[model samples]
Target: MTERISDFAAIAGRYALRQPLRIELEETGMNNTTRMIYAGEERYVLRVYDNHRDREIAGTEHAILSELQRADLSFRVPAPVSNRDGATITEAPDGKLAAVFGYIAGQRPSPESGAHVEGLGRAAGELTLALAALNPDARLAPAYKPYYDFENTHAAMNEASVKTLCESSPKLAEQAAKAASLLETRRRLTALTERFKELPQQWIHGDIVFANALADGDAIAGLLDFEFCAVDARAMEPAVVLAEFPGEDDALAMNRMRRFCRGYGSKAGLGADEIRLLPDLMQLRLMDVWLHFAGRLAEGLDPERVWLRETERVSFACGWIDRHRRQLDVLFAAMAERQAAI
Candidate 1:
């Protein structure tokens, strides 16, 4: 292996120039392991990518970071550490790619922080707007990629190879089959894609959940994680945010939706069709999660894991499907009506 935690000390010892005072690992991130090394009064964030991530992806992330830094947006992005040759990337002992960022002093926000939510929305909106402004014709290396057509709900569920992975486990067998069925239901809603005719395409932060953002009270302190960044429908960005937020009522959700839309519209306006499709996009988000849960269950993940580790998860997903089924129909009808109106 090229990048293991044990070698981190030696790597830092070579780079810090000055003696490091303390180094500690942060455990929150799932895809990459992060460590904070304090060299005297200054702090730096060391990020180690997973083995599955290739060098090209690392270079792509560097390009995205460089773009965001130059965009001069109203948020913090981790700065890459330049080597003795002023290169941003350095290979670790475990054969993994490593980069460093100046640590932003802030804490990850909780679901309850309204100010944080607003700030996050604003930051994301700004980033989306900036990315949208960039010409699609810009020259990029082979590693730089735009996010596109990643809505894998149907394909993942229907894959025969994926099914085979679950067949040995009875619990997963049922869940995988259910997941495939749900995906079919979602497939029936393909007409919604036409709504995107009026919706603009832009670069989007694919994962805008709370965990990936940092806040100081209601202010967005930093936006992190560009691994899933890609080009996609502009509305898809807000849809992703709304999908992750926790709210029990339509009123609260609508409020959040309005905040997000208003922020984005203040810059780039949304068409009537795009507005109508927002609710359906939110539902699509929910369906995505359920299908993912089913896929996990099929993959022999604990029948009951975390909050969803129970037989009831299946029933809950089904209940959500039944309740939202009519809403989806209405939403699709609204989309058609908007198309007619436009």
Candidate 2:
């Protein structure tokens, strides 16, 4: 607690906020320490990253936000604030890097709302185009491996490690066994890899679940968190978002996904190949999540249930997609046709 208090004091000094500013921890994100800061009439967010320690990566995140602010899209995104030295990333006393973003006052949109889901899609589509334009920067750096780079990405997550971690509990073991079976065949599918090779590559936010976006009524107030920004297949952008659509069965899931795609297609183009590969790409996204959480649990950073929840979600999503492959094809084809018509 003393260390935390000292860090807050240093942050206030460096940011030139009023002395002894009121800072309270925000109990939301899983990977980072987020704090809401109150300075007289102003408010801001202090994000202390837990996933990566590289300042260059953080700088690239800020640069992306800086460029996005210039893009002037229809909605808002987190804006990085510069400290007294005009540096967006502040080195904390304990060596972790931190940055403050202007606070956005809005709530996370409901996934159940068609308008909210559609709006999220439009924002993603707009960002896809904008980020594509903003890429190949000399300062651009990777925050996390792209989802499709399964080998280099999941190499550390070996079966032995996963098995040992699973032994800790029967519930987790079942989730692990389910994940292992589901991922084995899908990850080895040559067509998934080969098809996406022809698609365009560009910078994407890489993580865009609904929690990352703040909504004002039915509209997107701002997009938050770019910690996973990476240069990847352009189509991978929407697939990541689509994987976040939740439902008990294929119809309900597809409804939300189709709405998101309609909104996205209306704003951006999805080629025939891109459209066809979306289902496979979305499965890959789920795979990444399960593997990511598994790795986190193995390293003792996360508990069993945290990983279990995501594994179950991934398990259900993968099966849901497979059972409805024909619908998946029709859905994306429709999305492509709609985009072309527009």
Candidate 3:
């Protein structure tokens, strides 16, 4: 890590900083190489693009954050700290695109913390409301491709990938078969694409998993990591957050989802069509995860031994979601109604 830190000395030099800059590697997401930098009394985050694809998206995220800062959002979001040359993104000696941001202080929430869950939901709602005011075309520097796009979903579920995924594990194979059947019987693929097209599109923080959110007691102190941000169907913002709610228990998970939807609806109220499509959107989210993990297993990339556990989680969640579809629809509908009345 120290060796990698040294490579960014030139990039760090571009920033107007106090003497004796200290760099420490941050162990977080798999996508980016993040470092915490201390320059005298001030702290900041330096992120180096790990993949080529992310390099293209960096400018859009910086622009989006800049816009969010101007909005005076209630929660803390990363503010781009431009270098001495006034460039938010600087090319490193190694050719990786790097950017600096003012550090936000908070801890990642524990799965068992109820306050954290509610706080996350509230923060998500507030963030969505704030983002809704921004026009995607005005803020995004380079166009972004959404990970949750129905076209991507179709490609992931194509026959070849499905076969490979099913062949990787017997347990997953059964689940894959079920998922494929559900896709057809539910008319999920066509319905989602059509509905998504009809719904309003907006710039969204596409990845709002727990790791990406920071909490202070019962409040969300910071919303971190906007690498997956994009302009997409508005419902996807809340759907992604709800899908990633931390828990292994089905009842608890459903309760958490209900709380999240309620929180979101309170601020950025869902439309009648969006409310009706909520259940399917969530199912799409789960199916997306299912395909992602299954693809990883098929590719034999379980270096961390997390794929099996993730696969099990996705499989069970999909089945559970299918069984309780009617209940989820009712819950979301009620939330929308309450919001409308308010």
Candidate 4:
């Protein structure tokens, strides 16, 4: 892997270039390249956008973070660092959008701790309330589409596309055939399209999985990676989070989900309608992953291991969610009752 440090040299020049600069590349984040920069006593993260490579989108995220930094939240949100020019955004040598954020103090959370899972849910709830309070430009929302548009957003992810992918290699055929599950998810979400509009809409941190939620002790302290933030169904916030905890099977994850919903409800209450749609919204989140991974595999950007895991994830989670619909409704209703909003 090319360090590409030299490519970022121009952008890095904007910040205080302390002697013997040290930049370490991170191993995570599929859509963006991240580097940790140590400048004297201060540590910061430099992210180069690979998903859209659009400066406006980066600006939108920075704007959102700026507003969130001032919001009435208990935890921390990443604040973009301004350069010498009093600007948060700068372009790298490759013309990709890049920005530096003061490194938040925390570690990746583990699912073993029920408090941690619950804390992440609480963080999700807090963030949901914060995003709902923001009144940014209406244009900032349209660029980032909701997860419900899984099919159109990824035009080539249809059944025929996956069939072509399956025929491409004998080894991929079995795993690749699972794309049908995504098609099914889209169908379900499609049937509820009108109802979704009737519920509510707001700016949301569309991706709130463990990788993006940082933990200080047993509770989530900071939220990272707003690159996927967008306007979507209000419930998409928690659904995005719940979709990530489908451990081994559904049993372990449901226990965690219970605690999560409790913690979340304590901060922000869910409406009766949102509660009813939680299962489908969670399934929507899964198919969104499916579409993303399938899009990557089709483009030759990733191997089958990448897409197969997502396909298998969708299959397991959606199946389990379908089997436990009544249980989900009950759990969400309990969550709404526990909310501080009520």
Give all candidates' CA lDDT scores. Answer: 0.61, 0.82, 0.73, 0.80
Per lDDT, the best of the predicted structures is 2
Model 2, which residues run further than 4 Å from truth? 18-20, 163-169, 189-191
Displacement of the residue 281 alpha carbon in candidate 4, Å: 0.4
Candidate 4 collision pairs: none
CA displacement after TM-score superposition, residue 284 of candidate 4 (Å)? 0.5
Candidate 2 per-residue C-alpha lDDT over 22-98 given as tens digits, one digit per residue, 9 for 90 to 100: 88876559778888888888888988887778998898889999888898698888899999999999988888889
Q: Please report, as a residue range, the 10-residue window in candidate 2 with the lowest summed lDDT.
A: 182-191
Candidate 3: residue 287 lDDT (0-100): 65
Candidate number that wins on TM-score, 1 or 2: 2
1-342: candidate 1 lDDT, tens digit per residue: 334556787556546444545778665476777888888889988877863457666766677777778886777877777766576777777677777777887888765666666677677778777777654433323332322222443456554644564465565566665545544546544455555544676667767777888887677888888776666677777667765543456556445545554444434444566566665565555655554555665566635342134223433444453565455345434434543444
RMSD in order of candidates: 5.2, 2.0, 2.9, 2.1
Off by over 4 Å in 3: 53-56, 138-142, 153-157, 168-187, 245-248, 294-306
lDDT of 4 by residue, 187-306 (tens): 778788777777688889888888887888887888888877878889989998887776665678789999889878877777888888889899888877777787788888998788
The Cα RMSD of model 2 versus the native structure comes to 2.0
Q: Which parts of model 1 are misplaced by more than 4 Å?
A: 1-3, 14-17, 136-148, 151-156, 159-181, 189-198, 262-268, 284-342
State in Å the error of residue 46, model 2: 1.1
